[model samples]
Every structure is written in structure tokens, then in C-alpha cells.
Target chain A: MDYGTTPLHGLPSRVTICEVGPRDGLQNEQAVLPVEVKAEFVARLVDAGHTLIETTSFVPAKWIPQLADAEELLDAITLAPGVRYPVLVPNERGLERALAAGVRDIAVFGSVTETFARRNLNRTVDESLAMFTPVVARAREAGLGVRGYLSMCFGDPWEGEVPVERVVEVATRMMALGCTQLSLGDTIGVATPGRVVAVLDALAAAGIPVDAIAVHFHDTYGQALANTFTALGHGVTTIDASAGGLGGCPYAGSATGNLATEDLLWHLHGLGIETGIDLQKMVDTSIWLAAKLGRPSPSRAVTALGDPLPR
Target chain B: MDYGTTPLHGLPSRVTICEVGPRDGLQNEQAVLPVEVKAEFVARLVDAGHTLIETTSFVPAKWIPQLADAEELLDAITLAPGVRYPVLVPNERGLERALAAGVRDIAVFGSVTETFARRNLNRTVDESLAMFTPVVARAREAGLGVRGYLSMCFGDPWEGEVPVERVVEVATRMMALGCTQLSLGDTIGVATPGRVVAVLDALAAAGIPVDAIAVHFHDTYGQALANTFTALGHGVTTIDASAGGLGGCPYAGSATGNLATEDLLWHLHGLGIETGIDLQKMVDTSIWLAAKLGRPSPSRAVTALGDPLPR
Candidate 1:
């Protein structure tokens, strides 16, 4: 419990964790919980001091049955005053659905690799960008903050290692769509620290400030926290994580879940960086949600500190 | 897998991994594997390009029945040239047994906290040091390499938080006792990157060179890999790991296993740090060992890539 507070140089004094358990996490789950449960999940996260939570996606019910009750979930939960609930909006139709739900922040998910763009978004790279362009434009016009998610920025299943230049190009295009923040994702979770530095340096070289970038990593090879450490050293302040390491890549068959929020907080809070989230509360939330999901949480922090709350 | 080799500025280009699955890992398991299986495990690790391995301990059979066949195991396996197999020796008796078994490298385990020293070594901190003094002296006089393991270097359950000065003091004593190398252990896995940096910096300030220090971390809170990354940044080239994340702290009820060698290799190899071990071979070894132990591996790399061996 006593994490000796020692701050490192060149790292952010505070970090913003964007909880994606309700959306990115549940979307890949086989068990579809009721809308009320999803609502409670978001509420528990907010109670744990998460200010930014990705509520759900507005995709069609037939596509992702797990998150089909997005509208009902939004209606079921109370919106905290300062909390920002961002929903993933794939295209113009999804954006319309989000707007109707009184969403203030929306995110557009794009793919860095051509193969993933076609497979995941059902469009080529440029076509997917074209689809998101109007969605972002409309969201921006509606005074909704737009967050751009660039998936497969590190690697792609069909197309091996993604080029940094290609990621930079797609990232700039996504940012040009009026997105306030861009979450660079290692979709298949094959990124190491060096590759992380390379991509971030390339983005900086392309005139993209570190403040505008958020890192979303997976623990597929147990490199998530280490890679996150590298990103923090590069001055990245925003991170996307799931409560219990909830979601695996639906595309990459061997991919693991997103970096667990508990694990990330353990690293952040130990470094004397203020995140404003209660570690114990978040661990309890993850444990409670894991029971609802009929499985144990994959987060190491949850596994180690979950059973009896570890003093 | 095209890890995009980009070396960090301050990290070591090559790292030496000391595989402890046979000794440190198996010691905590309820199932005591046959000596033949243990020999094969060591063989497989050597085949996977591990240059250094902790073969077994010289403790009495009553203390650790799991490694009771230490002499038999040393005789059963073929010791490859250039590979160093270190055996744990508790005192002069254990050292005599290790020397009788023809062990060229022996390690003495000490504690940074007094409570753990009394609980684990059955002696107070200074008393334990006094006990190890003669063993280290005799080992060095016998032309054998000596490694000193300082456990609970970051936090202690009974003591709460361990001071940095205490760690440096014990580390210097261990080194002064003629230990060729000293491994700083985060026994309960409660360490973070900043604390790791702080400890290493304090040790460096106390005239303990980085090259003489190795890091042994547990993944109790999922901070092992992140903490290892911090150690590498501090120019510590040697790392202690277990195949398949084999061992858990018997003292800490909620503690998980040691840092998985497969997971560690995934990070090190991905960073373009030359640790000669083959990742696939190590994963296969963990999978095979997990099967023999009748349990799935705790390593994320094994879980993510072990299903069918991703292309």
C-alpha cells in the first residue's frame, strides 16, 4: 500500500486515464449483459474517479450484439457533471445516433493499415477516412469534442509491421478531421518500447505535439505497461485502458485484451503522478465486473490485490 | 515478428537473463516434480540459449522438499560449456553440499527488511549477514562465483515501507562479503519505476556500480516488466526471471509469481536488446512445463501466443 513516491524527470505530473471498459471492452465479449448492468459499470467507474469514460459505440445491433443497448444504457445512467463519456461513432449514422443520445464527446475509429481498414471498417484506408470526415465535421459543428482512434498503428495481422510514415500520414489525416485528441493504438499489441519511441518521435517530427496524443496498448505480449512507460517518458498524458483488461482484438485471433486500468494506475500512482483515481475502488470495480462477466479479471493488479483487497 | 529495432539511448544493448524456474520457481509449487522432469527443464532452457540458470538449492530436504534432489539433478543434466548454473546455498553446510555437487556458482539469499530476514532466514538482518559471511568467503576461496540476493528491497509487509538507506546498506554489505554480483529483489512486487530508479540511484551513490547489480522482480502487481524497464534504463544488464512465471511468494498470501521469462524476453527482444534466448523456444518450454504441472501458465505472452504459435 505504501508506494514510495519518487517522481521521474520528463514525465507528466498528472495523467488522464480514459476508461474504455463499457465500450471497447464489452464489444468483444461473448456474453451480452443488460443495459442496466452496462449503466452501472459506467457509474462505478465514475465513482472510482474516472473523469473520461468511453460509454459505448453506436454501431448497429446486428453487428455487435454485446453493445446493442447503447441508447438504453445512456438513458439508464446519471451523467456526472464534469465527467466526459465518449462514444465510438463509426460513420455518419453512428454519429447521428450519438448526437440523438445527447453525447458531448464522440470518437472516430480509423485503421492505419490498409488491410485492417478494409477488414474492420469494411472500407479501404482512404474510404474509411472519407466516411469519418463527415462524422467528425458534424460532431465538431455540434460542439462535440472528437477523439480519433488510429488502430493498427504498431502492427497489422494481414500486413505485418506498419510503417511509421504511414501511421503518421493516417494520424495527421484523422487529426485534420477536427479531432481534439488522437489515441494511437497497438491494435495487435506487438509494440515494444523502441517502436513506441520511434512512432512518437515520427509524429513529433511531423509537427504533432505530444499533448494531442494518447496511447492505447494491449498486453498481448506483456509489453503494455513497459510501452506505456516509454510513452509517459515522451510526455504523453492521456491513456486508454479497460477496467479488467476487458477487450481482445476481434481481428487478431491471438491478441489479448486491452491494458488493464488497474495495472496502469498501479504504475502511475507509484511514480508520484497524480491521476485522481482511487486504486482500491478501481480494483473492486474490476472484481465486481469480472463476476458479472463470469470470469476472472486478467489484470495482474486485480489478480494479486482482488481477493481480499490486500490490506 | 519485425519488432522494429530501435534501441533506447541509455539502455544496455545486450542483457544477461538468469533463468530461475528450476530453483526459485518450482520451490513454491505444491506439486514436486520428478528430478528427471526438472533436468529436462534445465536442458530446455539451455537449448533456448540461456547462458545462466539457477539450477537448485542446497537447503535441507525438510526446508524445501521440491529441490531435495539437487545433487541428482546436477548429475542428471549435461552442463553446456559457457553456461553458468548457480545453486542457492544457505550456509557453510549448504555451501559444502553445493561444492560437493561441483557447483561453480553459488548464491546466498538475504533480506533488506529485518522481519523477512527473521521469517525467511530464521535470523535477524545482521545475524543473517553474519551467517552468509563465512559461506561467501568459503565459496570465493573455492574459486566459485557468488551472487547475493537481497529480498524485499522495495517494500515489506510487516515493516510497511523500507527506506532507501537500509537497502543500500545491506547491498553494500552483501557486496563486501565478496559477492561477485548482487540482485536487488522486489519480493512482494510492490515497486514502481520511480522507486526502482530511486533505489538504483541510491545504490550508485553508495559506490555500488551499475554493472555489479542485477534486478529480480515479481509480477505481483503487474509492475515487474515496467520495473525491469526502469532497471534497464539505469544500465543494469543482468535480470533474474522464471520460465512460465513459475513461482509465487509463499509469504505473501496475495502475491503472484515471479516475472515470466517469456514475458521478459518479449520485452527485451522487442526493444532490440540482444538477449540470445529464442522467444518461441522459451514459450514452448513454458507451455510444456505448464502441462507437466497441470496448470496453465501465468504469463501473458504464453497465454496470447501459446494457443497455436502465431505466425
Candidate 2:
């Protein structure tokens, strides 16, 4: 073995990938695949050894009609015994719907930017967080796993440069209020490797454990992987990625999509890190869905692997 | 600074970027830009703070007709002071042509995989390296800088998993011949962060200094940035990138272009590395060139920064 070729230090040994395709990816799609197709996609991801699958969002139908079938999709999908299936909940109502659908894991979202919060959720940051408090309390009482999302943690379209102090405050508050994990989202794809480190450094000063932190970055700026490395260097273990690089953040103007799961796995697996995901199968599912949706996958990895089913 | 939210460990503080758009990007293009356009592109890249620009190839017109104007473009473009503009020279004939054109820096090409060499250059590995030895010797005598490129340093379509020993022998021989830099080219874009670390480790064990190494990876797998980080961890300082994510390796099946310069800068700059390149300006140039080529830039960073140009 060429010891010279292997990295001597600062390489992540294992990375926990949180596949957000089912929620973040499918939610933005205009052509909704049937609920069964959605379930099949999630199952395929599970079969590929993805441990954390964000199945669907329980947002009001009026808000995002595309994910109106979230309950049915969650109920219909076969749950792999060890896999964690989480659903997105906007408020107490959304959490009620998710709990009724037998969701054991729930995620609550809030925006660090005030403009994005008002535009996306029709509530101010304070209002949104206030609304989510009950939902988090209920979920904890119901013995459900809850993850808190601080969207636009780095920068926002309406308000650029989300203050690190504000992000830390919001994250600390969320985690203090029954949330087990806090993912800082770079909604507009503006986070650079430097800024990621800066933000992580700030969070570290606040005494947050590296293992509890997750990063959600968009590929819009094409810095997603680089940002991931910044997070990894900070010892962040959980990374959020979408399958096939699907799903555009509606609030993020001109942003393309999230980093693709296949691409993410390729890097993690290549580093000798244990991601526990199969690359070839994930490529197959992305191709299947891209064909059904009649849109090319935004993932270069999927394209390079070839559209296993050539139309 | 709300330092409590930051994760600690594994992040890079700075990064190195090598711009290859003018050479690797333009060579694979079908609709060749005029010599003036090429010259302008180089000037703009220099203005954008690109320190290392691979300007063009001295290969025969029959091979890559797109870059036949290499000499004219080099002559027309004003070489920014302190910028190292390197051109690819396949053998003695190519080197002679480049030398006559007043080229001060040249890169010699070889392949790690036997089949790829035969298919790409119509020469066997030994035959190709044998051809480069004389060119390397002549260039050394001329007091010009010489760099050796080992293509398919990662995986190859014709022959997969290029052995570290093969790469080591080729790289060691090139270094012995007085080459200042050895660029490991992932022609097929299949390298993961692990593979990158593995390859770099192998080379280091072979007694190669990390500072003398450069990496050229394709975004075919969307792991270029990730791989770059791994390389940085091993102390590899130079990196090869294409402007606007311009071109794919024609011979490497499914290989996309080098990682985009704008994207690379985003990551590097983020890592607190002083690349001295302006992000907004870089994106503007990429968008301008993408229009000139009558295609959307393959650079997601350019697209994400969308229309930074004043309307």
C-alpha cells in the first residue's frame, strides 16, 4: 500500500447520510409521481442501505399540493426495521397528521432569515418557532424522534448573511426544546467552505458537540461538496442530501437543487468512510424517477453512470 | 460570534487552484472559438486572478483540431506578470513547436492504463513515456518549466483500478527527469475522496513530495471538490480546474470537464485560502463564455450566482 497516497490526517472515517429526497426532493417537484411510486423510491433508497430516509412532509395541502399525499406515501412504504423514516412537520397540525399516519420520527423547520420565514411559512421567525414549540412538545410526549431544521443558516435571498449568533441562538433554543438533532441549512447555496467553518466554529464556541450537528447545503453555488468537507472537518457526522439531486428550495431563487445522494455516497465511500449505501442501486432509482418525471436528473453522477433504462 | 454552534475538526483552512479551462476545456469543444476569443478568455481569466493557467496544447491539429490555434492565441494574449501559463506538449515535435512559439512552460502527457494510452494516443505506455523523455530533456536544457501529467490516475473505462505502482513509476520517472510538478489526472472522473487519499498516499510513500503534486479531476462523478479536499489534507498544493466547467475528456467515456474554476474558488475562498480571484467576476466571465459557446455553462456555481452581470 502506498502510504504516500492515503491521506495522513483529518479524513472522516464514517459519515451518516440523511437522505432528504422523499421530503425535500419530492416536495418541489411539479409532476408528482403516484404515492406508490414515491414509496417505491423510498424503499429503493432503504434497500441501498440508506439508514435515514426523510419520507414526506405534512405541510397543509394548500401550501404544497405536491406533497398532499404525504400521509398515504408514509403509510404505504414498507419500513425497514433499522431505518429511521422522518416526516417534515410545519406546526402542531402537521405533526398531528404525521403522528396519525404512524410516523415515529418528525422534523420541525424554521428559517433563520425573517423574510424567508414570512414568505415561506406565512409567519415571522418568532411566530414559526412559537408554533413549532407545541409540535415538538407533542412529538416528545408521544415518544417520537424529533429533528430541528434551521433553514438559511448561512445566507438567505431576502436577507443575506444570516448572523452566526442568530443561528447559534436558534439552534440552541431548538435543541433545548426537545429536539435531538439540529441541521443548519444553507438554503440559497451561498455557504462557502470558509463560511461553513466560520459558522461551525461559532457553534463550537457555543459548546455544541460536533456529532450532534448536521449540515444541509444546496448545490446552487456548486460548493455543496466543498461545504460538506468543511462540515466534516468540524467532525459533523450527519449530512443531508437529496437523491438524484432533486428538489429546488422554492424560497431560494435560482438555486438548482440539493446535493445528490449518489454523488455524496461516491465521495464518502471513496474515503473509506462507512456510509452503508450502495451506489449502483441509487443510480438506478434516480434514473427510474427521472424518466417517470420526464425531467433529466440534475445529478452529474447519475448521468455519468448512464440512464440504465434508455428511453 | 456564537461559536457554540460550530463543529470542530477535519476542515481545511486553505486550498490551491490550477486553472485548466484554456487547455483542457477548449480542446474538447466542437465549435472552436476564434484565436481572439481564446486570447480574450485567457486575459479575463488572468484578470480574475488565475495564477496557473494551462493555456493550450501543442498536439497536432489532426488530433485536437479545436486547439490548433494554440500558438496564435498564446502570441495574442498578454501574459500577466507572475502567471505561469503552461501548454500541453505530447512529444518532441509538439515541444519544438511550443518552444518556437516562445512557450516558457510545458506539460508532458502519459497514461497509467495501457488500453487508454493505446486508444487515446495510439501509443503504448512505455512508448509514450519514451517519447516524452527527449522532450523533457530538451525543455530542461531550454530552462523552461516542465510538468508531467498522468491521465487515468483513478479508474479507467478500458482498464479499471489503475495500480498505485504504475502511477508511482510514471510519476517518479517524470520527477527524475526534472519535471517540477506531477499532475494526476482523473480522466474518467471516477475518483472518490478515499481513492484520492489512497492515490496521494501511494505517491507520497514513493518519495514524492506533497508540494510537488497537483490534481486534475473531472466532475463526472460530482466528487471533484470532495476529492480536492482529500488532496489538500495530504498537502497537495496545486489543483487543475476548467473555467465555466467547459469540456469533458473526449477519450474518457462519460468523463465531464474539470471541476469549474468558479466552483473551485468558492470552495477555496471558503476555506480561508487567498486565491485572490473575485467570485462575482469569475461567475460573470463564465456566463459570458457560456453564451459565446451557445451553451449553458456546466458550472453549477456560475448558474447559481445567476446574472451577476448588470442587466
Candidate 3:
């Protein structure tokens, strides 16, 4: 009932920003950049004070060809002290590949919808969850921090709308699978703040602690920042954002991309929430990446703040 | 507390959208469209099921030349029986001009910041309010529904952050002057949902009903729709938005423009809140307007939901 902006809104004083530009962002880009460009982008994000960076995905080279140079990228960039590099691991083989590439932290992705699980991972929802369990266990046994991704948590293109209860059930099981953190992903970006609150409350009621949850949102419908704020208000931190909103998946009905790092930081800095992100540096990075990607960034702040108006 | 995406999140079942694209939107444009084009734009909006279209402003030609077509535009358009055409009146002379143009609904604009008032109206806040007293009286005596706009309610670029109480005071004074509704304007777009809730709750504590208040936001920081969602949660229904998020004022520090109607409709429709807007038609109007304005729209929905990717 406290309607004040004095940091008492249950938002975390310091939020962990998991920069996913190198892996999630570039993998969705139509034009694949050179491995050095990807490495530099990661290095720039690291320079911008992002402690946790999703470096790459260890899937087969053909699966996400844009990020095929995951190993090449990892080798080129210097791993700084206190910085965590988390890469996506689809299964044990992906985990092995990631381990071979010196990945100490890894993400395992699943889906709440049967259709997304089927189409994306070629497995049903239960099958995908079943698949992630061992991958997570193996990663944790390897002393790697595991981040669980629950895709289509809000709505799926084929499934219409996802129930919060279903999401909660799967999320709980994922956390039970030794996953350290769960990021409830709105893959289609249809989740509103109200819906976000609903999902988070459902997870809490099912005994999932707030400390174990991160909210990853795509800015498809411009609901990303608002949903992020709502998540923050619910004691959720560890937001996953892409530099320049890089991953615009055109095949996915309405997936614009992940929340832009600059856009997210602007709101956080304004609300006095510390993310330790040098926003001006992020903007410069986004502008630089926008050029390398051969497109404008979908970030509102990137467009509004400094980038020249195309008009 | 129900985390269900059901209809019961304290949001109004029906919401009113006041279209301010013409008066507020075009006035900020660098290039002025001719009177006929402006008239056609208004007609297109009316055809797209917007009942309340802010047709034009009756201010001096030199001040806001973009809307200098006030008389001509009002004269050209055929006002529908049920649709309300609200033209802005800056003073008694502007009101007289509006009345001469057969306007039945009018709006009076003011600023919460003394700096904005001095810059825009050439007076301090008190002096500007004093100047509007007779304008409101004349418009009310003529039986015209007068909507009041209190800008910089959340922030002022020159004066910095405006306290919620100062906003409430100016808003209360505006409502007392026979203004039918008071729009709390986040002119600088620095308002977050928490700030919005704080300001609205302060107003409610001051005995103002949420029904009599509307929120006007610019998408400067990508907080418009989120702020709107927060306002809706507080039982405030009426919202102000531009058709294409058309108003981008470069000089306003952070004020990008009004929240796009398409972006707003996208979120409301997603939440199952009814606005009676034909979103496709609105998109078409925006596409057409964007072409006329020689720039891509700042609206995410306009870009994402067909109308062609402006990237």
C-alpha cells in the first residue's frame, strides 16, 4: 500500500543484470558477426560493469549458426576476475562442450508450453523438463551455477495463453533439479505487470523463494521494462537483458528481442535502483553494435537518448 | 492479490482514451502540415472509432504554427453527432475563437513548473493559472466541457523533480476552476509506476476521485504504458495518448512524446481491458500519418504489429 518511490517498493537495492547480448542477442541476429566482433561486444559489456554475462550457447553449430563461434568467442575474450560467464547448455553433450570451452556457469532452457518445447527443442514440455534435470544436475556437480530458463511462461504463439499454475509447477521442479536460479521467460513479450505479479505470486505460493527467481522479458510489445519493474517490486532481481535488444526472432510470431540493456538501466538509474551499469557506456555500445548488426537497436532509450534520429 | 490474468485486477472494465495527437502531437512537430492534411488526419482518427479527438488549438499562429489551422480544420471536418471535438483554448481570446469555430468541447493547458509556464505561456505558474481562470469561466458559461492539463506534474527539466503534493495542488486548483477532468501530465516522461502511484494516491487522499482524473504520459523513458497500468490499478480509467506516439519534443530534455495509442491498445487488449478501438484501423492511420510526417512512428505496436517494420 506504500505508493512512494523511496526504495521501499520491495525492489532490490542492487539488481544483478545478466547481460545476454553475446549469446542470446547475436544468436538471433540474421547476419552473423565475426567471432572477434562478438568477443568485443562481450568485452564492451564487461567494461560497462555487467558482472554476469551470458557469453554463448553450447548447442550444435547448425542449431544457432550465428553463435556457432561460441568457443572462438570465449577463447578471444579475457575472463576478468569477479565476472561470471554463463553459457547455455541444452543437454549433457552441450554441457560437455561448454565444460571443454572452460564455461564455469551455464544456463539450461525449458518451456512451459508443450508446443514450444516440441517446436524449439523437439520435445514436449515434460520431455524438455526431463531433459534439463540431468543437465542441471551435471552442471551443479561440476561446481557450475545453473540458471534455469522457463520459456513461454506467459504465452506461446501456438498455445495461446499459459497458466501461471503450470508455469509455477514446472519452475518449482526446475529449481528442485539443482538449478540455482530460475528465469521465467515471456518469450513472446505478452506478459503485463498484472500478469507478471500473478505468475510471481503463484511461484511464491508454491514455495519458490524470491531470491531464486529472475525475470527475462522480450520487448516485443513494449511491456519489458514495466514487467521488469513489477518483478523488481515483488523482490525479484537478476534481470536478463540484451545489449541493443539484439535477438529479434522474426519466425516467432511477436518476439521483438530481449529488454534493451540501456533502456533497462535508464529506468533503474532513475528509480535510484543501482545496477552498477554505466548507461552512457551501454548506449555507446548499443550504437556501436547497432552498426555492426546492420540495423537500429529496438531500445527506446538507445533511440531517444543519443542515437541520431533517422528522420 | 489474485495473480490470475482474469478481469479482476482493479482495472476498469471500460476505459476512455482521449486522443491528443492533433493538438499536443502536431504542435511539437518541426514541420507543419497544411490545414487540409491535418483535417484529414482528424477525420481518419474519427473514422477509426476515436470519439474524443483533440481537433486543433486556438492559440496564436506564431506560438504554435502547426495548429494554426484551428479555425480551418474545425470548419472542414463534419463533427459527428456523438463524437466530441475538443479544441485547446489558451485564454479568453482563444476560447472566443474556439466558440466562433463552433467548438462545444475545449481544453486548457497549464504547467506545474514555473519554468515551463514561463517558457511556454510567458508567465509564472500562478500568473498562468490566473490567466486561465477567465478562460475556464467563459468556456463553462458557454457550456463547453473543459479538460484541464497540468504539465510537468512529475518532473521539470529546469526545476528538477516536482513533489507529488505540488502536482496535487495545481491539479486541485484546475479541477476547482470548473474543469471537467484533470490530466496529470508527465511532461518530461520521468515518472515511473511507483511515482505515478504515489502522485495518484496523494490526489486520492486529497479527496479527488480517480474517475475525475486522467493520466497523460510521454513515452520518453518507455514508462508510459507501465505508468498507465499502475494508474488503471488505482481505478483511474481515462488515459490520454497520441495516435502514433507522434509528439517528440527535442527541447524538453527527456519528453519523447505522448504514449502511442497503438502501444496502449496493444497492452489493454492483451489484458482484456476494452477500449472499443479498432487497432488495425488505428495502425493504418498511424502508417498514413507517418508517411505524411516524413518519419517512422515511435510506436512499438505500430512497428511490430504490421504497418511494416520501420527499421
Candidate 4:
């Protein structure tokens, strides 16, 4: 509806939204959909103009039953031209599965703090990075782009406020593992804008160009969009968002969903930045998925723009 | 819980949050609480360390039956020392009512667009301003502080994209009537960070000091916090918020609640900015109010921190 535009300096004219709804989002959701539905979800995101979609995770089904049909879902969906579907591969086994499935882009998740590393990865920070090394190395050898996810960059529920220097050190180590992009995760959604800027500044000082960094924020504290805005001001062009704000942190029970793609698009577009996303189409997709899950979408944009659901 | 703090440059170390829950928030709610409950709400807000609270509106009960007990509610609440209770006064008669009730601070509501002025104030923009002129004048004459509220400063449902210059002109005129503070309201909640910057810049160019301005944003499109952050960066220290995200625009059907005070506190305190309000106390008050209203608070911070209610 032409929500007015006023351009800000120092912001990129265009941004790439990394759609994580299919993989990260579904992995955390309780309702397990059919493989066909998962495939359709990926297709709808592609239709909504998402070029980079995390299609699914190859983690063991025992750990995440919601994405148990990763291979079947990947096979069921038609691969669109010029779109990149990145799958999460935890270790060597998941990498082999992704390789067999013809995945071209893959992501390996790590943690910045020892507590989260032990809790989420069943290892210390060093052990998790050691685990990701082989997966990232083998994927890079296969000519596949690797994205490193460094979680708990802001605040860890168990560890409290994470040190900025520690984040920079871990982020550097992860980026050195043949990763093309590093997405800093606010796993607990506890980051404010200044902390976001501090982390980005530290990364830049460590020689990590803004172009190679992406921000992944959770809206648990309603600071995701503002954090994303701060990241954009620092010249980070890629944002990791779940369509419909689908994912909640499994490790931190209080964490809400990722920054909603619809909400992010509203801000990006309203600032005269190009996202190439159809906001209405994305909102409609969230509504459609919400119905499938028998729940309303957590996205504020979806709630404000979509029709009222029947009681 | 200490959310990590990293101070940003050029932001005020402390900000004044104007609590608008009792007046703006409750006026939009469907359930009409008794005058005693309304009084308790104000008392709770003062206890949570809000120095400026909009206690009630002296508008006719026929217009807003939800706030029919404005005088009684004010009478029931004990005013805390060093706290300011500002009541909304529409015109001469409303000012008389507020004065009779011993109100030391009064606010006059105006519009930045013609349609909203006609629809909400039942007059044109000029007519509305003319009506507020006498009210603001009398309030100032009586040695009471006068606040001017300019709504639809960002966008309007009927008249889309209100011009920046128009907002500046109306705001200048409103402030000229001896308003100690002028609040820019994004009533429809369509503002983004850039638009916020644009309006604030225009106002500054027109000789309006940042200290004399406040921002009132709605979370309808999930832009309020981001917009608020942008406003803070522009040196705005006064933020208008409703506890528990309580208000929705009566004129804009799809509009969501105001920026929740708890959510705003999370961002402000996380940035190392002080608000003097206890976060836990505010969340508790919102939880208590939500229970009385038979609904959960829309605040993300409250939802994340407060225990989940049984379905």
C-alpha cells in the first residue's frame, strides 16, 4: 500500500534475505508436516522471491522429527532456476547425505559460548568447531558454498552476556573454515542495537568485510528488526529470517521466533531499499502455513495485514 | 536478568517515557474497567518509575464510554511526588473539567492530515487546531503544562503518506500555541526508520529542538521499536508508550497496539540507556493488567519473561 519511503545514508540499496523458515523454522516447530507440505513451503518461498532458502537440515530424524523427511522433501520440490537452497549438514554423515541429494550450498552451525556449545552441540566450543571443520572442508572441496552459523553472539541464557572479543575470535575461526558467509546468531534474542553495532564493528576490525557477514536475530525481546537495521547500517547485506517468524530457540525455552521476513521486508522496502520480495505474497504464504499448522503466524505484519481468523 | 549493554554514541544516557496506558491505552479497549482499577493502573505505573503519565482524557463519555470515569479515576489515584499526570483536554469545556479536577498538566490532540482531523476530531485540520488553540492557551494561562499531540504524522489510512513539510508546519503551529512538548504520532503505524529520520530532520530544520519532541509509534506493522530507535538516535528523549501494548487506533481498523512499554524498556536498557523504570515491575504490572482484561499482553518482553497463562 505504498508505506512511505525515505532513504537513509550508509545503507545498501539492495539486501538479500536468507529464508530459514523451511529448515531452521520447521526444525523447532512441534507440528510435523508431510514431506509434500515441506516441499510446497519451499516452493512458496521461492515464489515469494526468496533466492536463498535453507531447504532442510540433514540432521538425524531422531533429533528433529519435524524434518525427518529431508531427502524426500528435497526430492519432491522442483528446483527453480537461479535460486539457492542451502541445507544444514551437521557432520560428515549429513554432508554425505546432502552430497547425495545434490545440495550445492550447505551451512554448519557452531556456538560462541561454552554453555550453548555444550547444550546445543553436545560439545565445547572448540569441539563443535572441530566437528564443523571436516564438513565445511569436504563441502568446499565439492565446490559447494559453505555458510557458518555462530550462535549466541549476543547473550546466552546460561552464560549471560557473551564477550565481544570471544565472538570475534570464534567468528574468525569459523570464517577461516572455508565458509563464504558467516551469520551471527542472537540465539536468545537478547541483543540491543548497540551490542549489534559493537559485534559488527569488532568483526570488521578483525578483517571480516561486511559483505561476507549476515545477521540472524530472534524477536524474543522485539529487538530483531532494530538489530537488523543496525546491521544494515554497518553494510551487512544479508539477513537470515524465517518466513512467518516460524522458529523459536529450542535450547533457550523463552526465545521467540526469528525476525519475520514480512516484517523485515516492510522495514527494508519502506527505507527505499530493494529486497525483490512481494510483501503481500509473503504475508499470504505465512497465512497459508499458519492454517496448515493450526495456529496464527507470530509475524506482526501477517497479523496486521491478513484477515481475521474465524473463532 | 541483565540483557547485555553496549552504549551507542550520540544517544541520551537517560530517556523519559510518557506512560499513556491509562488514557490512550484504555480508551481503545473494549472492556471498561471500574474507576478504581484505572486508578490502580496509574499507581502501578508510578511505582514502576514512570515520571510522566497520561492519567485520563476529559473527553465526553458519550464519545468514549471506556474512559467515562476520568474525573473519578483521577480522584481515586494518589499522585506520587515528582510525577506528572497529564490529562487529555479537547477544548474549552474539557479544559474547564480538567482544571476543576486540579489537573496540573493537560494535552490537546490535533491531526497532521485532513481526513484524520475530520474523522477523529470531527473537524478539518485547521478547525481542530483552532479548537485546540484556546484549550492550550487557557491551560498555559492557568500555569498548567500543555502538551500537543499531532497524530497521523507518518501515514494516514484515508490520505496516504502525509508529507514531511506538512507535519513540520502543523507541528510548528501546535508548538507555537505554547505547548511545552509536541508528540509526533504514527497513528496508523506505517512509519519505518527512514521516514522517522525524515520527519525529525524536518522538524529540526524548522527550529524545533529535539528535547521538545516526543515520538508515539504503533506496532501495527512491526516498525515501532525500530522507529523508536531511530528517533532516539536523533536525540529524542521523550518516548510515548502504553504499558502492555494496550492501545489500538480507533480510526485505523487494522492498526495494532502502541509500542509496549516493556518492549521499549528492553531496547532502551539494553542500549545502556536509563529509564529509571524497573523492568520486572513493569512486566508484572502488565501481567496483572492483562489478567484483569481477560487477554494476554501483546508485549514481547512480557510474554518472554512472564509465565505463560493456562489456556
> In model 3, how large is the Cα lDDT of residue A15?
91
Pairs in clash, predicted candidate 3: A198-B3
Q: Write the per-residue lDDT of candidate 3 for residues B151-242, one digit (tens) a residue.
A: 88888777777888898888888888889989888887767766787888899999888888999988876778878887888898899999
Is 2 or 4 the stronger prediction by DockQ? 4
Give me the overall lDDT of model 3: 0.83
Q: In model 1, where do residues sit more than 4 Å from their true spots?
A: A309-311
- Per-candidate chain B TM: 0.98, 0.94, 0.95, 0.98
Best by lDDT: 4
Candidate 2 lDDT, B12-121, residue by residue in tens = 44445778888889888777899988888889888888888889998998899999988788889887789988899988889989888888899988888898889987
Which runs of model 3 end up more than 4 angstroms from their true locations?
A1-8, A307-311, B1-5, B34-36, B250-253, B307-311
Clashes of each: 0, 33, 1, 0
Q: Residue A39 of candidate 4: its Cα lDDT? A: 82
Tens digits of lDDT, candidate 1, B1-311: 56466677788889999998999999989889999999999999999999999999998999999999999999998989999999999999999999888889999999999999988988999999999999999999999999999999989877878999999999999999999999998988989998898999999999999999999999988999999999998899999999999997777676679999999998887777999999889989999999899999999888877887454
Give the poorly placed runs of model 2, Cα more than 4 Å off.
A1-14, A201-207, A307-311, B1-16, B308-311
Candidate 1 TM-score restricted to chain A: 0.98
Superior by DockQ: candidate 1 or candidate 2: 1
TM-score of each: 0.99, 0.91, 0.92, 0.98
List model 2 lDDT by residue over A1-311, tens digit each. 01112332576778889999988998888787898898889889989989999988888888888889987887798778999999999888888888888889999888887888888888988888889888999999999989898988887776666778888888888877888888889877877765788778888899777777899988986878878976886789899999999997876566679989888876766666778888889999999999888998989889887644221
Model 3 lDDT at residue B56: 89
Q: What is the lDDT of residue B77 in candidate 2?
A: 82
**Cand. 2: chain B TM-score:** 0.94
Error of 1 at B67 (Å): 0.9
